[model samples]
Target: MNDLLQTYTFLNQAMQSDSLLCLAQAVCWLDPLWRGYDEDFYHDPDGILSAALVVTRQLFPDLYVDAIDKLRQGATYATVDQLICEGISNTGIPLDNLEYLPYGIPLPAYGVELNDADFYTTHPEVIPILACFGISPEANPYHMTIPDCVYTAAEIIATDLAKRPEEQYQQVAWGLLWLTSATNNSICDWDAELMMEVEPLAWETNDLAFARVMIEEADEIMGDVLTGLYWLTSEPAVMQAMQDNIHRIYKAIQKKGKNNDAPNIRLKWVDLAICPE
Candidate 1:
């Protein structure tokens, strides 16, 4: 098989695996609390700041584990920032001379900027690695927005999809669909909606009949629950149906191979499923 097909198969296998499913569940469970930091930070700076320091650790576990451990031991943000500075220094990227931006600036763009010649020339692996966590180096890279994290992740994935051949559109759609499903249960519905919004025109050319089938299945199985809660409730049967639908589409893509006749299914129900009414 070609590289794109190989990638499709790998992603499908990973999504179908039990471990990623559990990881999705864990992310969903913690999403509400993660979102709360947005509002809480303004009202309770210390508390929210501390919570953010801890959660931000998830983005760079290798570099931030020691920082996280210190935070758990009641280390303040200053202490954590010191640890991060040391970690960056250890990576040979000197941060002491860089000018810092205020916290909460837009992330994906900033992430892109970080990958530019200035930073990437010195830290070649930095952009791709930070892209994974939705982070870009800012002067004050100590803070991040929850929404930006979601957006950056989808943006990076979509950009990757775009760089591939047009025949891979179905795989891109399925990939975004899987990401949407995985992250939908989280506080940010915008990631899925953004994926839908940035959807390439190639996706619009998908087989309408197959698209309708997927939509109807999703509607029947999910109904208003998808919109009403902005997340899937603990409905086992419905969730299973959703998973089966995803796998069915995956199989279809695999069967079609590079035929270009593979269903690039898009659905009106997708908006209704994800957006708040």
Candidate 2:
């Protein structure tokens, strides 16, 4: 465990510098036995490292596929995604078929494909950062919270905020911003629900920098959510789930402020029926 921890530490700092080299080294270090050990490892310390690798791969597609090819040949580079897929296929785990794994239904339709230029124009802000991760703006960022994408993204972000509470608020806040500004449908809601599960540590010892970033981002997102004020077209249950989550997030940020020096993050849900003119 200590060896794994140290390797992750080195990788984390390395990621701040040369991401590809760090990814290559981490993938090499996380031999198949350790990575493929079990499903639980994905949630443990290893989760953070695994997500870094996934994001790293996203940024460098050629490197990601090359690493995947290498790991597949080796016995130790098993992915939690592949394992879950295998269990669903081979074992009777009550999991959905691969096609329906992200949500228990078939994938939702994303209409009217656009070229990269047009797509980026549609989502000017989000595409650049996502592009750095190798996800074309054309690809859906909305999938970030789905089960298939969560282990690699949502949960990883959650874990990062938890262990490093000073940054938790900002992380969650930025996550919300990305969710609403960039994602389509219930995706942002999904990210918020996952993020709301983690409890932020007290403000005294936590890093104020991360918290500030989170607050700034959340404030921006709230503005957008309130201003756009569009009704969703997904199933009522899904939409309700998202609304309930929005309420929870609204309350959580309010509660955190009352309890600590955490930033006052407000979410204003507008009532369109009664417009003030």
Enumerate residue pairs that collide in model 2.
32-76, 32-77, 33-76, 58-133, 59-133, 166-207, 170-214
Q: What is the TM-score of each candidate against the true structure?
A: 0.21, 0.20
Question: Quick one: best lDDT, which candidate?
Answer: 1
- Model 2 off-target regions past 4 Å? 1-119, 138-147, 167-169, 176-277
- Candidate 1 lDDT over 44-75, as tens digits, reads 34453444443334433565456545644777
* Model 1, runs deviating above 4 Å: 1-59, 97-277
**Model 1 whole-model lDDT (C-alpha atoms):** 0.40
